[model samples]
Target: MDETQPLLPDPDLACDEAQDEAAGKDFVDFDPAGDAENPMDWPEAYKWGIVGLLALMAFTVTFTCISVVPVATRIVDDLDGGHASRSASVLLVTIWELGEAAGPLLIAPLSEMFGRYPVMNAANLLFIAAVVLAALSRSAAAFIGARALTGLAVASNVLNPAIVGDMFPSEQRGTAMSWIQLAPLIGGAVGPAISGAIAETLGWRNVLWMSATLAITCEAVFLTCFRETYKVAILRRRAARLRRETGDPALRTVFDVEGVSRSQKLWEAITRPFSVLAGSGVLQSLSVFGAVSFAYFYIMATTLPDILETLYGLSAAAAGSALISFSIGSLVSVAICNRALDGIYVRMRDANKGVGQPEYRLPLLVFGGFALPLVASLYGWTARAHLPVPLLIFTVGVMGATMLLSFLPLTAYVVDAFGLYAASAMTVVIVTRCLAGTFIPLASERLVDRFGYGVGLSLIGCFSLLFAPIPALVLRYGPKWRQRSRYTREAEAS
Candidate 1:
């Protein structure tokens, strides 16, 4: 029970003794907690190399997601004869998010069954092909379709959290999670910041070509460097090897002893996110709040360029440069949260008699919930009043930091709550947020046109305030709700 050591159980000891006894003597697992094969026991430098690669992959996928925002108008003008409706133009940007929402359903389960290495590399290859199609597209429909395919193929965004869970202990995960989660936020911000200039100088197709290049590079590194990390998948491979070496068909891992077919496990894995969402009130609340955060973030990302153009007469490139404030704010949030998250969690666990609960991750979330409204209101009203551009930029930075404050803790909570099924649990959050990202920004332009920036944004702030109590409620009631959830209970038992 060394304080610095990971809390993972020895794979052999975790199996039911009676089940192993009844099944006969030949079985295979990592017998010692410090087994080199255990992902958590890998050399620190090696583990961090994997994390850096995953972070890069996460950055690439999300960078593609938002990179087109600054160039949406140019795209429509070139591809649609400048006659497409506002909704239709917006669809080109948002459709990618819809594809993101759909990908995790199959990818999460497949990764669980096979392993992270194969599933991720296969998806990365598809991602590169889709990006190439997008670059070659000449029509709006073709381009939207390509973007959607790319989103569907980008599995790293959803899978990275689970990979982090596989490799790091709970108390040590905060800094790594910050890197993974911050990549998307920074990517989403940096994408639009540079893309406007790229589109203006090179054209919209070149933006996609740039994305394709990044995708290709990421795939090359990932395939060559990443290895299998999922413990079940690793153990199953070991068991199969042992059976061959010893000539004993009786040799098994726990998965083999369970007597479940691959198809059945895949089917259940596909549906488990929905089941977990439907059954767990904690998940339901988190999804709602997470969706709100995503919607607000995307609404700003999709609308800011136009808003700045209209309100301040800024050029597209200048407006896009303004978004670099968001990247700056995200870096600041990472500095603050990375230093505070694990320290706070450890202190709270000690206070709770040296036991950790998922709710311990909620303190930062509660702070974020209240801060979101203030920043949203400020962002809206400043633009409405034609305030100084620097002031408006400052508000955007605050908004960016506040969003991550809510996002990082929410992610950490789900990973902690649903240990074995972290990927599936994370799917619930990603799918919900991506759905919100797809649809919410579609209405933002209209809302601004009708209500003005102040009223429209204040309305969003009000909606956020309504759900701001969610983390607090979960903190109070989560344990009882977890006890009632078959999914959470099963996760805990495993």
Candidate 2:
């Protein structure tokens, strides 16, 4: 055996009987390069169908995360008898993010070990139940706990990108991921945009009921249409069928050839994200950049309603309506900028002698990184100045567009760099960003109270400015760093 040979068999190749006999083991894989059962070889329409379902699921789950933002005070007052602390009220929203922080660490790995379909559907069921629980809760603790549970079930956010990676190769992944990425932005924005009106008309409980209803609808469609996309899980099933049909128990997949027990595989999958994060400085830097960028978005989500209501004397419904600008910006970016992500990468790759490197994805990040700080500062100063409603709306819109600019490329870079370990790599990024999303909003009020919107948000913008050079640095040194990384090296070699 060549010492440098990859651990996993080439997914696109047939089982080589001679090689297997030489190695004293039979390993199953996609027998033909264009095997229809292989997700990569599935019909383009079907692959896109899966992406569409994933986008819907992503929107549904993320919708629940922020739908209550517009009605947080109403929820706290109704459930807590109007006596809850400000921190407690904020926790009603932030605790859900805490659940998001914890969920992907467990869920993404489980998806890798089991399969995408069962895990996602199961999480969807849990999310529906959790949202319904939130609607029925009569106390602050119960409502907060329900939100936390809902967050834990937000597997779609973590799994969507991994599923895209499973179905689409590197060349087309950015385009597929752009659609997936658009969902959460739209979901998060639309949630607050409509929830305030719903809460005002029907009560906060109805807001949760609306989220639960959407989740149930998405789950029904998903269960009906979504197919398993995890390559190892699909191949394992194929191997199992072959074993039963041929009565050859020795037949195995490259994943199973090691004779690892389900328990061992599960344990490794669960911990792999952390191990990868611990060992990879590139991943760590990306996680930090993503975390702060994520925090900026949540801070805006949680704070914007109050900013509009207080500074501009808008009604709750009007304040919520103002957030529609975010959706508008996100929509515009997805339509215009996201499609260019893959185009830019291909251009860079072609320029690099027809070899693609993960650094190619970093070009968009350069624009996003520098633009984010400026947008953040603009949002701050515009709000502090009590600028015209249209100006504030435009600023908020730009903020939404800028966030997607940063996040979409960053996600593509991680997916490209990590390859087979993309799920775990994404889990690392998800965990860090969720933690930031969870905790940073808790301080948003204090930041505004102590420093006012201009200085407080400008401070955040300044913090973001420090990270603007990250993409440039990564673009210059990424290949060398990836060469040093066991995970990236294995992914590349494989």
Candidate 3:
């Protein structure tokens, strides 16, 4: 290979693609993003292993956030609060998720710089320490700080889908990534129920101790098992090795495009997530709905313990047990939808003569979108009406079904719509909804106080109604918008 010959025209450079088209060079630049050595070509077993470990990590972090909800009363007492104690107590969950949301914007770039394994391992270790800090905290401020510290694992939350995108073909990605996507909802639903029992038998601090032990065990397994899979970082290492062996300073990876400084690329990467977030209509509608539903989930998860104990006269453990309904609902949705997701997309692509459009992912939203308002209305109004405890629990479960269903179609759509920029797009959705989740629960006790559960939830139910037709509207109008979109074309091709 001639070191001086300009590296095969970099197709990743849109400008170069245009120039080559006009010059009739018939040369396609090497694209490390999708080369034969692409991470997608890695063995399926290896990819599944990575997904499994990442799922375990995601489950751990999510559990840390929600398990504490069942113990909110104990935590408030432990912190020795005043009149405002209960509200302060529940802030723990919100603060922790806030950390989860913000961690990626600051830490994700390091993963891009170093590699996923090192950052993940390092973040896992830091996460354990944060759990320890939460366990030992003597004051509310200390506990809040520690909970935010756990947000260091935000990379796991934001990056897993990007990993899915990197490793799986577009057609098969929804099915494969469903395993990763499903973990959070399951983990979120499981923790409060089980932790309530653990809090009863052991203590609240022991809940943190239990979670720390889980995190440590998963970290040990992951450290021993997983390797880096980000293709650019992998190729950079390979290029460095060759440069060292051949004593040719010019040997470079495909990522080494002329005139694109490392800082410039990093700046672009840092800022592009927001740019894509702000620039796209498709992203805006999906993200707004995601944020609202997610906020609804947090409100429900954080408040259920209180709701059950106060209204149904259930014990702390029994109150936590109510989460079983939520967890079961989410699982049922994933089981049914994951099977249908890929088939729907593939059929649409086949119908279009092998040209794939992101809208193929929208039809499933027909079921999901309707489920949101329908269940929110029932859950909200029925709870407010002081219906039978069993009936209320059943309605909560129904809401869980709607919650998970609502999330899946939009997630698959965004992933297909954004492609290589999926991380940025996802980060936008995460940050927006997480902030909403963080603040909305703070108002939960107040909302129930002013409006009562029935009316308060009905308001939320009505909100859910607004976005229900999004899939249909997008299906009809999305192609026209995509024509005007700067990111949509790049996303589809990638």
Candidate 4:
């Protein structure tokens, strides 16, 4: 084979393991004979194409996460197992987030043990089936069950960063990560916009059907475009092939370098997140801050329709249309992040004697931390006062922009902080985030009812104010902590 030829010529990878000891023989399992078999050695076009597909997958799963919000009332009426309150009906959203919090705990480890493809494809299929069940549901339990399953499946998207790290070197990771960051927000934003319109015109069930269609479309794209990005899965295939070709059961891969067994690997994959999360003050603080911020973000997002509908008396479709501003704001904010995030990191690195640290991502968050809460308060109070349509939308837009300003950097910071274990660290981020999404907003409805939109939103914004110092703390003290820890020190040393 030509040294330059792509190791993964197809999406399906044939990988391997090893038990070789001859000084002249290849002893490394799935060893890159040169740079040829390394994921980083793939052509840029292939790397980026894979990134695009992964982003689409993330978007599809996230879109389903909140798509039901616009039609919560309709679902309540259509499937009355008993007298479920409006709030109780909308708890389905929380149910989904609940599932998301646990899904990564189970699926991500399996993805490590097996491969990303089998896990991801199976999850996507379950998501599709869940959507159908939601659409055809005859009782609240069935629909809520489906929503929880959907949440569980969607958590797979949280692992996409591992693939980015697998393919892109540190220099190119920021831009690609920024793009992946947009998927969840964009998916969350667009879902209600389309679902509200569909529910108003076609029926509530069509909202789920539309989401199902999107799942199908994204899965097709995934099947065609994404190769097995997991190193173990790829090398395991290679090891298997080598064993078959040479009839040597003695062959093994480098994963055997430490004599780690399948059970031990599985145990490590499962327990590491919790242990690391508990051990690292950095991960703990980041998880809490990220969770609260995201909870409030979703609180604002899911409740916007309710606010607009109650305060301004807009129709379902109009309220949905109003949400376009949020989506627009989120999309524009991501574009800015994609363009500026890497530039900022590169510039700061250049100015600091060619040094790079995760904290370099913090300066943007400093601005975001203070600005987002203030603007979010404005959005809340403006909605409370029933302010002019233009002003409300603009305030919400600014909130969207500031939200991503902090949100995008935090994920990148964790990726940089954890390096090879970015996926494990990300599980904590995802779990904290989903916990917030699942629970915090459950109170928003009552909060708004009691204090009105302005006061309620201001309350949430106050929490943002409280957590604002997190990035700065990490910026100032993060290096020392990294030096103390094994994982991040490895990142820094490398």
Candidate 5:
């Protein structure tokens, strides 16, 4: 390794854990001070500034995925000789989710191999190129390909939390996570209206162009401002460089002092997340709940426009604006959860004789879960008969319920249980949800045809109800469940 020449290769800017019965050895240890430049050790203002920038990065990526699709319906129709099939339109909506689902699973692990900054910036730039291709797309196939490319490139959703976790301590992390979570929810709620308005005013191609411009601008900012945060990885790289350049056999890395390495560590870094997910019952339980809730949200996002536009005869813009109600619902739930979840955690911790687990975050789950199904049923029945907009807004309330109850549990549980692998655990959850999101647009029309909106939505509601008890059961038995995991016990002990 060279002192000045980078340790990890340029193409792969590059980047490790362990156990019991191995006395006098750390299970997992890495340098605390990395690269003289790890953002985790940056000044407070610097860290928070990166957080804000990343938040916008998140906003740009997410808003692009979600917002541009609705407006794309017009383009699809125009391309299809001015008569795109309803199902075809849904494919356009849902296929982007397929790309989203794939991106995190495929690309997130690369962060360990490469540094986080490089991976994130590269992905955003790729996403910008995809949007450019999308803007120039002449056929539906080209457009869908571009969408998938964009999705794959910007799979930053999984890594965003990891970035934040690196910046904040556990106790104060919820506030940061909460704010991060809000961006996607707001993006989902507002994307369609923005896109729809843009499409209706300018040609549909301009929507893609606008998204590309945003992506490029954001990418530029990230390249200019972002810093690497994975501490151990950076130190390992630094040590490797020092060894190569100086060629001192006695040369030791900061990581050597802390006992981390980058040589064979890359595979462990990539695979360990799955190992943690498989080994932890708590992760499994929380993942299921979170994934299902996420799936329902995607389903709603895919179907809501169809419901309003077709059934209510609302214009594209009006139907898109209806998502504002969903946005309101999400905001309301976020407000309620932020105010109350912490209080409940403290009270529960006190009641438990000064110790608490992630399960304490589940109280709102019961309220949110049960209420959503009932709300769905009400929305279905009323809307089936052409009820007032207020009735539809009430359905937004049900959707809001899901957000309120699920967000805290999902974010907190992974943070509590998997700790370092929270991003990976969230990856699993996002995969399932994004899959559901992709499927909904493909199937929404068929579902309504076969059973009508009343039945189809009611069915989704029932499924939600079935999964609602998940968090409740976890809250009840979470501690005992956690005791069975070697990792959880070790994290708690520390």
Candidate 6:
């Protein structure tokens, strides 16, 4: 460990066969942004615990956002809106997601420059303040601003899965991801019901207050439970701490390259995600699929309560209760996938003689692609036709299948394909998904109005069916495609 000796190469970059190449590379002069003591190498139990904690944090933020819209009518009444009241009311929900959509494009890349903890901690604080501000707002402008701030804070929720990917081995990714996907599903389903009840019993303002309280609580939990998992960040911090204790400024750490300055490294850290996205086919494909699914979820979320309350003569509380079916569907899918995904992985491995590849994750995606559009078609048609409540519930059942099938594949594929830069790849996923979530709500009512719910839903279903061929296409050409990717090579070399 001589100061002048070149540091060892990133262990993650050096797989079983690449160890020799790693040894011959003069250790690449350690850079924290690229160094690799990734969380994926951690013990299984510890990793799963981290996954559970992050999932809870995600659930809390997402739950609060979706629920707030159900009580928008009450808030609008309290705000004394004239003709513009309706537009103002809708902005409260839309602004939050719009802000969230902007975050990864802005803040996430910075996390790689600094560290995950700093970004997460700052975002959590922003979320709490935004919620508090919204609670105190007496005007529409104030309310809209508060919601935007909250969305900025909630944007970090996108990074949690990337952290989990960093923490667990790729083979065991499905189970950990189950919790991640499950949290959002549960949140989206339960948000309206719980918010509706609270709004009725307490007040619309109290809903934001309650949300602030939850945000504060989650911030505390994250501060206590979360650690810096981005290995390079951990090393950088460790190096600083060591320098402080020893009072030796000359003490070198793994990432302290002689020529490259920290600022240069920071620039690269911030830019790498975009660089990869521009260069890698795998990343581009997964992000597209992930974003589409996210858009569909948000569109459905914004529309469902409105449809239930207006068309079905259901009370706000009852309309919220109807979402329970969606939650049930999500849970059922997770349960089934958790049991089946590992077996699926093993079978793929056996078939390929242990040369496991990313294509293995696609089968689940295929199942989801088929289920999602069909469920949308069912829900749209059944609800529009004024069919029996049982039929609507059956649509929920179909949706559950879609959620189950899609969640594992996109997640697993991204983790396996992205290597150490999984966070950046996921950031792209987050940006696109949140954008879809934000934009879909704005146009969903219009789509339904113009085409009717059944037709609109069926159209979405057809579009989703087009995505079904993605997995097969990727399965056939994925590795060959990866071989041509410059970012993939950097990832493999990392």
Candidate RMSDs in Å, in order, are 3.3, 3.3, 4.4, 5.0, 5.6, 5.1
Assess candidate 6 and give its lDDT.
0.68
* Local distance difference test scores for all models: 0.80, 0.79, 0.74, 0.74, 0.66, 0.68
Model 2 pairs in collision:
none
lDDT of 2 by residue, 388-486 (tens): 989988988988887877788888888788876677888889889889888876776688779988998888788778878888889899889887877
Residue runs of model 5 more than 4 Å from their true location after superposition: 1-41, 241-270, 350-356, 440-444
Compose the digit string of candidate 1's lDDT tens values, residues 1-494: 11111112222344464266456656566656578888888999999888889889989987887888777877877888877666766788888889999998888888877888899999999999998898888888898999889888878767888888888888877888887766776787778877888887888788888888988898899878998988878888998898889889877765453555778878877887887788888898898898888677777776677778877888777888888888788778887889988888889888988888777888899888889887988898998998999999999999888888878888888888777557778899999988988887777767877998899888878877998999888888877788787556534211
How close to the true structure is residue 281 of candidate 5, measured as C-alpha lDDT? 80
Q: Give the backbone clash total of model 5.
A: 8
- Counting clashing residue pairs in each candidate, in order, gives 0, 0, 2, 18, 8, 4
Q: Per-candidate TM vs. native?
A: 0.93, 0.93, 0.90, 0.90, 0.85, 0.86
lDDT by residue for model 6 (1-494), tens: 21111112232332432453245532222443533444644566777778887887788787778787676756766776543454455566777767887676656666665667888888888888888888899877787787887788774455766676556655667777777778877887788788889888887777777777877888898899877776556656766776788877765434445676667766665666677789887777767776666566655655666777778777777777777777788788887778777668778877877777766767777768667777778888987898887678768766866865775677666666666556666667777777766765566556677898888877777776776666667767887888877545433211
Estimate, for each residue in 215-234, the C-alpha lDDT of model 4 and write its tens digit. 99988877777677777677
Q: 309-403 in candidate 5: lDDT tens per residue?
A: 77777777777777777767777777676677666777877888877566666787767666766676676677788888777867876676666
RMSD of 6: 5.1
Residue 353 lDDT (model 2): 82
Q: In model 2, which runs have C-alpha deviations exceeding 4 angstroms? A: 1-25, 257-259, 490-494
In TM-score terms, candidate 5 sits at: 0.85
